[model samples]
Every structure is written in structure tokens, then in C-alpha cells.
Target: MPALRIEGYVIVSADGRLADADNVMPDELKFEGDKRFFTAALDRADLIVHGRNSQEDQPNAPKRNRMILTRKVGATAPDPDNPKAILWNPSGASFEAACAEAGVRSGTVAIIGGPRVFDMFMDRYDTFWLSQAPRVHLPDGEACFPGVPARSPQEILAAHGLKPGQPQLLDPADGVSVTPWRRVA
Candidate 1:
């Protein structure tokens, strides 16, 4: 089997929230720079993976190789509405099998997230892009890593042996920054 690189991408608020209290991403929280960054990042990936919620949230997401992690059984086929995406039941099918089903040969696989999805790939990521809006605070919102009890994203990544790189400003006016973390060899 060819080596397949795995990476992660996420955006969180100052209060560590990934979405609003209703489990939806607010339009105001969307930063154009971040979108551009991720769009370009995915361009280099052979496949993109996300949970069902992420798939449903992006109704118009551009056609690209993708895997939608779902618990629904017998969904081992490509999504009819999205030619580039396949509905995968990880419990029923292995990730490698899903990649083969998606036609991904060998290249980076970007993992976009909901907390559940994020936690699932915590130990497998080689690189993770952590973007944040330090000035934005969502008091009643969903955390980046919902179920796993963690103090902060940085601490969590560090504990996983990921070394943080220099931070880049995604949007200067909005206090949005993105930091890349690479796992220690």
C-alpha cells in the first residue's frame, strides 16, 4: 500500500467553540481568507473526509474526492447527489476500503470535522491546521472537541506529539490566525 498522508483543518473561536449553540456555523463566523486557505489546501489532497453533519452542512460544496463518515449501514456507495463523495459506514467498511471506493490512490487526505470526526482521527493526523478567531467569543456554543475533555486545542495537539509552527494571519482585521502543527517523528 502506498503511503497516504493525513491532515486536519478546523476553525474555532476564542472561547474554543467550533459552532453555535444550535450546532450550526454562523455566517458571521465565516472568514473569506480561511475559506481560501482551506480550498487551496484541499486542492493538494487526494481525498477529503468528514462526518455526516459536515457533509449535510455543505450542500453546495464543490465536487471533490470525499468520504462522508456515517453510521447508516449499507451506505457503501457513492452519494448519488455528489459524484465525488461517498457515504461510508466506517463500522461496516474500513477506511482503506472507503479510499479505494473513492478512487484515491496516494496523496494527502484532509480531514474536516465535527467534534466526533475530529476525535476519531486524533491519533492518525500527520499535520493539523488550527485556525482561530481570538477576539470572537461564543459563550453558548459547541466546542471544537466536544466529547473529549481537553483544556485547549494547542495543549491537545501538543500532547499528541504535534509541534506547532509559526502562525499566519488569515484575516488581520478579524483577528483570525492559522497555525500548522506537524507530528513529531
Candidate 2:
């Protein structure tokens, strides 16, 4: 089998929160440039992986093959609501096995996440695309990673041995930029 390229995508507020206090991604965090970039990347992925609460609500969402991480499943099970989705429990089965059950033998695996889900793939990701809305700050909100509110997201990523690339301005007016952090070989 061809090697799987694992990558992650996330957008955070200046304070490193992924969502508001209510766990909702507010409109303030949404930028058209980031959305377009995210959609294009997901379009190229062979399989998308995320926790049960996270989803990229694109027009092609139903057609995209995805694996939803859930403790409710024993191992891997077909998603009854969506034929292209699979419910997976990592404690019960390996990621490769879950990918196999999802019919994705190879190609890129996109990790779009909630904090716990993003934490799970920290060491595994070949690259993580981090976008920041420098002007926004959601205090007492959901962090992009578990260490946030204590440690910055970059600090946690660097601790995992991933180095950031040059930041690309996604929306200059909105002060939004994206940086690709690659794991050291």
C-alpha cells in the first residue's frame, strides 16, 4: 500500500480558542480565504478524520469519505446516516484498520478537529496547517489543543517536534494568516 500522508487543519483566535464558551465556532472566526483554502485541501484528501462533533460542512460533505472518531463504537462500524462515513473507536482498532474499513487504502488523511481529536494526531501528522485570526480573542473558550490556556498552540506543536513554515496571509485585512507546521524527519 502507498504511504498515507497525514495532515491537520485548524483556525484559531488570537487567544488560541477554536470555539466560543458554548463550543460553537462563531462567525468572527470565519474568513472566506480560510474557508476556500480548507475546502480545496479537503477536496484533495482521500479520507477525512475528525471527532464526532467536528465536520467541514461543505456542499460535497455527503460525498466525501470520512471517519468519525467516537468511543461509542467497539472498533469500526459503518455510519448508518451517511454511507461514506465510518464511526471509529481508536481504543478498539488501529488507524490503518479504520482506514481500510472506510475503503481508503492510501492517499492523504485530513485531520480537521476538535481539541481532543487534534491532540490525538499531534505526533502522527506529517504537516499541520494552522490559521490564526490575530484580531479575535475568545477568552474562556475552547482551545485548539488541550495544552492551550496554559501553553500556546505553537509551543505544544513545537514540543511535538513540528516546525512552522513561513506564514501566509490568508486575509490581510482581517489579519488572518496560515502556517504549515511540518514534523522534523
Candidate 3:
């Protein structure tokens, strides 16, 4: 089997929330610098994995190969709406199988997510890029990862054997910064 370099990408509020109470990403969480970084990362990935609620809205999205995680499908099924996408159920199919079904042999796999989806890959990510919007706070919102709000995203990552690199300021004006948490070999 070809080894996949799995990477996760997410931006969260200072409180570690990824979305609002209704599972909506607020406008305040969207920063130009983060978006640029996200776009560039996804553009370099051979396969993009995400939950149904998470999607890339770039002009190149339609052409990018994607695997949408969902229980609606028994295993790997071709997405009728998008020729470049596959509906995958991890319970019924392995990640490698899903990648093959998506026609990706071996390359970087970018996992963009909602909380549940992000939780599923806790042990698999080689690097997780976590961006923070320092001034934003969502007390009742969805967490970036499973134990969030209760445990900070940083704490969760550290517990999972991922160490944070020096953070880069993505947008100083908005107090937005990103840290790459890499798995300790």
C-alpha cells in the first residue's frame, strides 16, 4: 500500500470553535491570509477529504478531486452531482480504498473538516495546520476538534503527540496566526 501524507487544515476562534451554534462559519472567522494559505495547500494536494458541510468554494474546486465523508453511502460511491467527487463511508471502506476509488495513487491528502470528521483523523495526520482568529470567541459554537472548549485545541494536539511549530502571523491586522502541529516521530 502506498503511504499517504495526511494533513489537516482548520481555522478556529480563540475559544477553539470552528463554527457558530447553527454549524455556520461566521464571516469573522474568514481571513484573507488564511484563505490564501488554505487555497495554496489544497491546490497542492492530490486528494481532498472533508465532511459534507466542509467544502472549498474556490474557482478551481470543481476540478479538484475530493472524497466526501458520509454515512449515506454504503462504501465508496461516485458523486452524481460532481464527477470529481466520491461519497465515502469509512466504516465500509478504508482510507486507501477511498483514495483508489478517487483515482489517487499516492500523494498528499488534505483533510478539511467539521468536528466529527476532524476527530476521525486524530491518529492519522502528519501535520495539522491550525489557524486562530484571536479576537473572535464563540462560546456555544462547534469545536474545531472533539475535546475543544473543555480542552484547548493546543492541549488536544499535544495530547495526541503533535507538537506545535512556531506560529506564523497570517494577518497581523486581524490578529490571525497559524501553527503547524506536526506528529512527533
Candidate 4:
């Protein structure tokens, strides 16, 4: 099996939430610095896997080949709404196979997510880029990994065998920082 190198990218509230309880990505928490970092990182990936909800959130998404994970679609099918995207159900199709079907031979597979999507790739992440804005706390927000132990996002990532590296300041003014956690061997 040619294991696909998977990387996770996410920005969370200070309290480790990906979004608010209603699945609303808070506009109040938006940071231009994080937007730039996210766009640049996804631009570098060969394939982007966006969960259904997250896909709906990105209206002006970049032009890139993507595998949209959706339970509504068949095991393997082209995303009718997105010509450049493929609807993939990993239960029947392997990650490598899905990539190949999407014409992705080799490169980093970036998994952009809602909690379920993030949880699905937990054990396989090569590196997970977790960015958080300490100034923004969503009191009744959605967690990065739902139903897991109530730990900081960094702790959850660490529990999955990914060790955090020094965080890079995305915006000192906004108090947002991103840490890259590489999976342990």
C-alpha cells in the first residue's frame, strides 16, 4: 500500500473549538493572518479533502483537485457540483485509490475538516497544523475532535502521537499562533 501522507489543517477558538455549537464559523474570530496561512498551505497540497459541511462553508475556494468526503454520494463518484472534485467514501475506496482516481499520483493529502473528518484521519496524519486564536473563545462552540477527552487541541494532537514544534506567530496583534505537530514514528 502506498500510504498517502495526510496532513490536517485547522484554526480553532482559544477554547479549542472549531466552530460554534450551531456549526457557525464565527466571523468575530476571523483572522487575516490565519486565512493567508491556510490558503498557502492548501495551495501546496496535491489533494484537499473537505468534509461536506466545510465544503459548503468555502464559497470562493481555490482552484485545486479535491476529494470531497460525503455520505450522500456513492462509494466513488465525481462531485456533480464541483467539476474538479471527486466524492469519495473511504470505506470502499482506499486513500491511495481515491487519489489515483482523482489523478493524484503523489503528494501531500490535506484533510480540511469538521470534527468527524478530522477524527477520521487522526491515526494517519503525517503532520497536523493547528492554529488557534487565544483572544477568541467560543463558549458554546464545536470542538476540534468531538467526543474525545476534553483536552487542549495540542494535547489531543499529542495523544494521537503527534509532537508539537515551536509555534509560529501568525499575527501578534491578534494573538494567533500555529503549531506544526509531526507524527511520531
Give lDDT per model, in order. 0.82, 0.94, 0.93, 0.83
Write out the backbone clash pairs for model 2.
none
Q: Write the per-residue lDDT of candidate 4 for residues 1-185, one digit (tens) a residue.
A: 45568999999888888888798788866788888888888778888997878852344464888998877755779888879899988787887787899998877888989788898888899999999888888878888887533777777788789999899999889889899999878
TM-score of each: 0.91, 0.98, 0.98, 0.91
lDDT of 2 by residue, 1-185 (tens): 66999999999999999999999899999999999889999999999999988898789788799999999989999999999999999999999999999998889999999899899999999999999999999997899999897999999999999999999999989989999999989
After the best TM-score superposition of candidate 4, give how far the Cα of residue 99 lies from its true spot, in angstroms.
1.4
* Backbone clash numbers for all candidates listed: 0, 0, 0, 0
Give the per-residue lDDT of model 1 (tens digit) for 1-185.
68789999988888778888898887667898988888788777888899877742343356568898877757478687778788888788887888888888689999988887887788888999999988877778888885422578888888778899999998999989999999888
Error of 1 at 67 (Å): 0.4
Greater lDDT among 3 and 4 belongs to 3
lDDT of 1 at 178: 97
lDDT of 3 by residue, 1-185 (tens): 68889999999999999999999999999999999999999999999999999998899899799999999999999999999999999999998888999999889999999888888888889999999999999999999998888899999988888999999999999989999999999
Q: Candidate 3: lDDT over CA atoms?
A: 0.93
